[model samples]
Each structure stands twice: as structure tokens, then as C-alpha cells.
Target: MQETYRRSADSAKGRQRRAELLESVTRDLAEHGLVDFSLRRAARAAGTTHKVLLYYFADGDDLLAQALLRLRGQRVGNALQAVAALPSGTLGDRIRAIWPMLEADATGLRVIDQAIGLAMYDPARYAHLAREAAEQYLAPLTGLLPPEWSSARREEVANLLLATFRGFLMDWRTTSDTTRIESALEALARAMDREAADGP
Candidate 1:
């Protein structure tokens, strides 16, 4: 479900500048999130003008898509590192160890929360973001699975866990019911542990 955005510019210098701008934009998105996101603000942070941004991007949406991809990459990369540092154990145990790290990333969660809301209230504008994020965000976790796991099984577990995690976030977002969500996540962890024990 990943979406494509602006490609590398033809000139080497242009491509380098585009990449640099994209890095700044990604940082802006991480720090400020999607709420009231502005091209001008991103341009200011990147030490460029909005017109230059448009020169690189078709429009703000195009810029946003590319920025989201970068953010997703960083978030997934961080998760991979955190997961790696955990004491080796069953896949579920590793997952459990990393769950807190995932949750602790409030900036990442904030970005996804915006996408989740957009997916519901304004799908025309945001559905792709959510869908793409679900795919991109879960990819690293899938890669962490045992070598015996086929690509098919890896994708299956990744999508399941990603959707389940998002569902928990949605519930929390809507109702602020941490107790119930925690209970549900606990049940899910147990189920995952059992499944990992049984193996594919």
C-alpha cells in the first residue's frame, strides 16, 4: 500500500538538494506532526523558499508523501535497533520487549494518529498515508522473524500485528480506555507467544 512521491531530480546537484530538503521536511514532520503542517514552515526550516519546495515536489501533498516515507523508515529503523538490543528469546518475547519502545515514540505515534483520523474522517486526503504507513512500519518487524519463516508467513504476522496495534491505538484515541486496551494487548501477546511456540 506504499505510495510513491517525487523522484530524484535529473541533475546530481538537484538530487542532492532534494534529498537534503526531504531530510529537513522529515524532521519537521516528526517534531510538529501533521497538525497544521505547512509548506512554508517546512521551507523555512529547510532554509529554502516554498517555491523551491514546489520545484522539487509537485505540490505539498507530494512533499508530504515523501516525508511520511522517510519518517516511516526512521521509525522502523529505530525499532529494529531497539529490538536487536533486547535479550534474545522467543519471537513473541522480543516483540514484547520492543512494544514499549514503539509506544514510547510519541512523535511517531502522533504522526500515525493524524493519519488514523484522516483515514476515518477524511479518507480522500489521508487513506493512502495510513495504508502505506501500515505496510512500511511493519516491514522491519517482519524481517526480524526467524529464518525459517517464509516471506508469506512474515507478511501475514506483520500485517496482523500492525492492524491489531493500530486498532488498539484507535480504541485509545476514541475512548481513552487504556485499561481495556491494555487487557486486549495482553491477550494478543499471549496468543502471539503461543503461535510462535507452535511455529510455521
Candidate 2:
């Protein structure tokens, strides 16, 4: 009976170890990106073996998805908090305030691009992550609006801003053209002013 109790306790220990492995994996992704991710490499980074990593994650993609999700969550949460910290401003003002803060390091950008690639490659496996990402990024912005706006209206504003931000960021990444991106941001700023002045 005591041995069975010990066995159950061991399961909990296994879970804790798995969580620790995940943290290490996410750290590895943050520092080095996931370009060469494999069961053996990831296991080595986590200070474990391939068989042990397989015990925790079914495959490389599974591990990658989970690690990327964790990384995205941290970034999204920080952006949301930063947006909330700024003084009251037009929706556009708040949007502009957060733009510069969102620029990630080379490794961070790699994580973002690679994660998006993963979703593009297998939407079914990563669709939930993609959805969660949008939701988390959009969630905190709803509070930036005037209290007079309806919940639905606030949500619409968030959706539009989120879409615009992502599009501009993609353009910046693709063209390496900050001049054009800044112009676009100015346009967005004007549009935000108009939206704040004219309801809906």
C-alpha cells in the first residue's frame, strides 16, 4: 500500500519535472530560437535524454508549440500591462505608445516568425495557439476606450487596431522600411483621432 502511495507521489514529481523542462525549453527558444529544434537537441538543452523528453512531449512539434505558446504569452501579457500603464489617451494614442515597445530582439523576432510558420504549416495543431495569441493581445486594449462605448464597439476597435498593428509589423519585417512604416503609423494615428471624435 505504501509503495502504491509512493507511486502516485512519483507521478506528481514527474509533472513538476515536466514543467521545469518546459521552462528550460522556453528559455532555449528565447535565447537561441527554434531553428534546429529536435528531440535530441531539445532534450540536451533541457539536460535530459531523448527518451525522457518523449515521455514528456509526444514529438518535436508538440514541444515547439508549447514552448512558443509560453513565450508568446509572456510577450502579450507585458504589452497589455504596458498599455494599461499609460495615461488615458485616445485609442490611437494608446496604440502608438505601445508600438516601439513591441519590437523584439533578433531571437524574439525569430520566435515570432517561426511560431507563425508553425501555425501556417499545421493550423489544426496550432490553431488554438494562434487564436489564444490574438485574444490575449486584443483583450487588454478593450479597456483603453472611452467608458461610453458599448462592449461590442470596444471589441471592434480592438480588432481593428490589432489587425493594423500586425499588418504594419509584417511590412516592416519584410521591407526593412521604417520610413514607410512610420508613415503608416501616422496614418493610423490620424484615423484614431477621427474615431475618438466620431463615435463608431
Candidate 3:
């Protein structure tokens, strides 16, 4: 009985430590992107030892995968809230309100873009994360559409909207032109509204 109780207590502590470490890694990724992320640095950031970090995350790649998942969850939550608060108006209004939120966190967006590139080379690592991101981040936008639309049509439109945002980010990253990015998003918003109304 004592052994069992001790094991239970240890499990709880382990879970709590893992959570804290994951949170620290997430903040670092959001602030610094993933390119320069180091497991030793993350351990220091979490106020723990490298051994402890390794115990929780087998390696840097594992740590990165978990960080990406957590970041994806956060972005999804923000997107959902943004959509919920959108006033009743044309799709442009909704898009405009959300565009700034996405633009404000350029580091996070760039990390995701980098993840996409990494996934191309590592299909196994990329496939699960990609599915999670699409289901969590993309599905919410799809939910904003009318229910009358077919599943295939809804997915197509959602992909287009997501692609437009990503494309705008790529341009903004290179050019740093807020006006051009805003103009492109505005045009895409109008196109989305037209497609949503036209059916499929």
C-alpha cells in the first residue's frame, strides 16, 4: 500500500513538472521562433536542470513537437474568440478584426511556417501535427460558414482563406509593408464573402 501511494504521488509531481516545462518552452517559441531553440536553454528558462528536461522530453525534436502542439492550441483559441466577437457585418469586417491579431504575433506565425517546411522533409513528424493544426485552427473558421454548404465545399473555402493568410504573412515577412498586406487581406475577404454566398 505504501509503495502504491508513493508511486501515485510521484506521478502527480511528474505531471505538474511536465506542464510547467511545456509552458516555458511555449513562451520561448512564441518569442524567439524555433530555429535557435535549445533544450538546455529551455531547461534554464523553466528553472530546471537539463536532466529534468530530458526526462520529460526525450530530445530537442520531441520538445519542439510538443511546443508546436501547444502553440497551435493557443492560436486556435485566439481565432475562435476573434470569430465569436466579430460583429454582424460583411466578411471583410470579420477578416480585418482577425488580421491584426495574426499580424501581431509574427514570431508564432513564422514558427508555424517553419514547421511546415520541416514537415515536408519529415513526413511522420509533420503528418500528426498538420492534422491537429488543420482540425483545430482551420475547422473553427469552417464552422463560421453556413451549415447548408457541403463538407467538400466548406473545406475548399477554408483552405483558401488559410492559404491567403499564410501568403500574406510570407509577403509581409519579406517586404514589411503593412499597407500591401492589409490590401491583400481586404481583397481576399471580399472574395471569400462572394464565394460563401455563391455556394461552393
Candidate 4:
């Protein structure tokens, strides 16, 4: 009985420690970009040794995957909360509603963009992370669509909206041209609103 209790306590402690470490790494990545991340760097950010990080995470990639996913979740969670606070509006309103939140989080967007760039740079290492991030963002947007639409249509629109938003985000980040980005977003919102209304 004592041995079992001891093991259970150890497992609980391990989980808590891992969560703390993950939070530290997430904050670090937010402050410092993920362009040249390494296990040692994460360990340094967490104020622990690389060996300790390995004990909790499989490797640098696994740690990065979790951190990126956490960042994405925070972004989605914030957007959902913002949307919930507003009155139900057109599809265009929803698109417009979410943009300011995304636009405000320069750090979060930078991390996401960096993750995508990393995945593209080395597909073998980071491709799964990028795919998972896409799915995470896609599901919530699909849920926001009208129920009358077919599943296929909702998914298709979700993909196009995400792609468009990502492109505009990159452009905005690179150019810092709010006027051009806002114009593009307005065009997108109009297009989406039309598609949603003219549906099967």
C-alpha cells in the first residue's frame, strides 16, 4: 500500500512539474521567437536542465509541439470569448470580429508564423505540428458557420477563410500596412458573407 501511494504521489508531482515547465517555455517562446529553438534553450527558459526537460518531454520537437499547440489554444479561446460577448451577426461580422483580436496579438501570430516556417523548412521534423495547428484553428471556425450548411461546405469555407486570414496576417506583419490589410479583410468578409447566404 505504501509503495503504491508513493508512486501515485510521484506521478502527480511529475505532471505538475511538466505543466509548469511547459508554461515557462510558452512564455519564453512568446517573448523570444521560435526561429532557432533548441532543447537547451527551452531548458534555460524553464530554469531547468535539458536532462530534466527530456524526462518530461520526448525531445525538443515534442516540447515545441506542445508549446505551439498551447499558444494556438489561447488564441482560439480568446476569440471564442470575444465572439460570445457580441450579438449574433452576419458571417462577415464574425470574420471582422475575430480579426482585431488576432491583429492585437503580434507575439502570438509571430510564434504561429514561425512554427509554419519551421515546418516548411524541415517537414520531416515539424510537419505534424503544423498540420495539428491547422486542424485546431479550423474546427472552431467551422463551428461558427451556419448549421444549415452542409458539412462539406462548412469545411471548405473554413479552409479558405483560414488560408486568406493567414495570408493577410503574413502580409500585415511583413509590411505593417494596416490600410491594405484592412481592405483585403473587408473584401474577404464580403465574399464570405455572400457565400454563406447563397448556400445550398
Candidate 5:
């Protein structure tokens, strides 16, 4: 009985440690970017041993992938929920309403930027994560669009939207230009509205 109890306690502790490690990794990637992040550094930042980090994550790539997934899921879920709550209106209104929420998730955006940079050299890893992000994050946004739009058009718009967002975020990180970001989004909203007015 005592052995079983000890085993259960150990399992709980392991779970807690893994969660802490993930949180630390998320913050580190957000703050420092992930160009040269090392697992040993993450372990030390988390106040844990390198072996412990390995126990939870296979390697730095695996840890980064999982961290990106977790951050994407949470932030995208919130953004989609906000978008859903917006009243039925022109696409511009919908897009504008959700911009603030997207802007607030700066950390999530940084994690995504890091993931994309890493994915360039590692197609297999990129494909795996791209699939997950598409299903969980991109699909929801596309689903919110008008049904008359074709699949190809929807895909194009989704890609453009994500690219625009990432570009603006990268600029914002360097320039801290909230006004420019807002103005750019405003232009996008107007353009999207014009496109909708023209109809399919």
C-alpha cells in the first residue's frame, strides 16, 4: 500500500515539474527569442537539472514544438472565442473586433515566429507543427468567413492574414509602434470590406 502511494506521489510530482518546465520555456522563448536557446539553459532557468528536462522532453526541438503547440492552442482558442462573440456584420467589423485580442497575445506570436524560423531547415518537424496549427488555429478563423468563398480563396486569405499578423508583430517587437499596427489593420479591414462588397 505504501509503495503504491509513493508511486502516485511521484507521478504527481513529475507532472508538476513538467508543467513548470513548460512554463519556463514559454517565457524564455518569448523574452529571448529561440535562435540560440539551449536545453541546458532552459533547465537552469527552471531551476531543474538537464536530465529532468530530458525526462519531460526528448530534446530541445521536441520541447520547442510542444511549447509552441501549447501556446498556440491557448491563444488561438481565446481569439476564436472572441471572434465568435462579435455580432454578425461585415468582415471588417469582425476583423477589427478581434485585433485587440490578437495584439494582446504577444508571447504567443513570438513563439510562433520562433517555430517558423526553426521549421525552415527542418521540414519534417515543420510539417508536423503546421498541421497541428492549421487544424486548431487556422481552421477556426477560416470557418468564420462567408460560405460563398471557395476553399482556395479561403486558404489564400488565411495565409495572407497570418503573414500580415506575423510581419506586424515582428515590426512591433522592434519598433513598438502600436499606431502603425493599428493603422495597418485598419487598412486591411477596409480592403476586406471592399472585397466583400464586390461579392464572389
Candidate 6:
């Protein structure tokens, strides 16, 4: 019994340590961006040794993927909370509420773009992560839509909104032209509102 208890305690401690490492890496990636990320770099960011990171993660890619996913989760969680507090209205209203939150996190967006670029560059290793990232982002956005709409309809709108948002984010990253992007965003929102009003 004592041996089992000791093992359980060790397991709990290990889990907690792993979580701390992950959190540290996620914050580092969010601030520094995910360019040429290596296990040694992650270790330095986490204030731990690479061997320690390997004990908790399979490899550098695995560590990087988890950090990116955590960053994405933080962004999505904040957006959901902010948007939920707002009164339900048109799709345009939701879009307007979400864009500012996303815009403010330019670092987060850039890191995510970098991860997507990894997938494009090395499909054998990173494509699954890109797909996972898409689903993780899409589900919450879809849930925010009106419940009366069919699953098909919600998913369709969610895909379009996600794609549009990604495009605008990429553009913003490239140009830093807030005025142009904001204007385009407003136009997109207005168009979505019109479509929502028309209904299925």
C-alpha cells in the first residue's frame, strides 16, 4: 500500500512539473514567436534542461505543437468569455467583438501563422497539428452561432469566418495596415450580417 501511495505521489508531482514546463514554453512562444524553435531553445525558455523536457515530451516538434495549442487555447478561451458577456446579436456583432481581441494579440497570431507554415513546409510531421488547430479553433466559433441553425449551416459559416479571419490576420502581419484591415473587416461583418438576416 505504501509503495502504491508513493508511486501515485510521484505521478502527481510529475504531472504538475510537466504542466509548469508546458506553461512556461507556451508563454515563451507567444512572446518570442515560433521561428527555428528547438528543444534546447524550449529548455532555455522553460528554465530547465532539454533532457527534462524530453522526459515529458516526445521531441521538439511535440513540445512546440503543444505550446502552440496552449497559446491557441488561451486566445480562444479569452475570446469566448468576452463574446459571451456581450448580448447575443447579429453575426456582425460577434465579428466586431472578436476582431479587437484577436488584433491585440499580434504576437499570438504570428506564432500561429508560423505553426501553420511549419505544416505547409513539412506535411509529414506537422499536417496533423494544423488540422487539429483548425478543429480546435472552429468548434468554439461554431458554438457561438445561433442554436436554431443546423450543424451544417453553423460549420459552413464557421469555416468561412475562420478562413476570412486568417486571411486578414496574414495581411495585417505583412502590412501592419490597421486602417485597411479594419475597413475590410467592417465590410466582411456587414456582408455576414446581411447573409444572417436572409437566413436558410
Task: Return the top candidate by TM-score.
Answer: 4
Candidate 6 lDDT over 1-200, as tens digits, reads: 65564455359787888899999998788888877678888899999999878778878888888888887887788778778878667878888888887777755656887777778899998897789788899998898777778889889989998888888877887889999999999998898888778776
Better of 1 and 2 by TM-score: 1
Off by over 4 Å in 5: 1-24, 27-36, 45-47, 105-111, 114-137
lDDT of 3 by residue, 18-93 (tens): 8888898888877777666788888877888877777777677788878888887666677667877876766656
Q: What are the per-residue Cα lDDT tens digits for candidate 1 across 106-199? A: 6654675666686788888778887888778776768767768778888888788888877876777679787887778778878877877776
TM-score versus the correct structure, for each prediction:
0.82, 0.80, 0.80, 0.90, 0.71, 0.88
Q: Give lDDT tens digits, candidate 2, residues 1-200.
A: 65564455369787798889999888888887767877888888899898777677767777877787788777766677777787677677777776776665544645765566566687977676566668767766677677788888888988988788777776876787988888889888888788889864
Scored by lDDT, the top model is 4
- Arranged by lDDT, best first: 4, 6, 1, 2, 5, 3
Clashes of 6: 0
Candidate 2 error regions (>4 Å): 1-12, 106-109, 121-128
- Model 5 Cα lDDT, one tens digit per residue, 49-73: 8876777777787887777877777
lDDT of 1 at 86: 75
**Each model's RMSD to truth, in Å?**
4.9, 3.6, 3.7, 3.2, 4.8, 3.4
TM-score of 5: 0.71
What local distance difference test score does each model get?
Answer: 0.76, 0.75, 0.74, 0.85, 0.74, 0.82
Among residues 3 or more apart in sequence or in different chains, the pairs in candidate 2 whose N, CA or C atoms overlap within 3 Å are: none
* Native-to-model Cα distance after best TM-score fit, residue 136 in candidate 1, in Å: 0.8
Write down the TM-score for model 6.
0.88
Question: Where is model 4 poorest over a 10-residue stretch in terms of lDDT?
Answer: 1-10
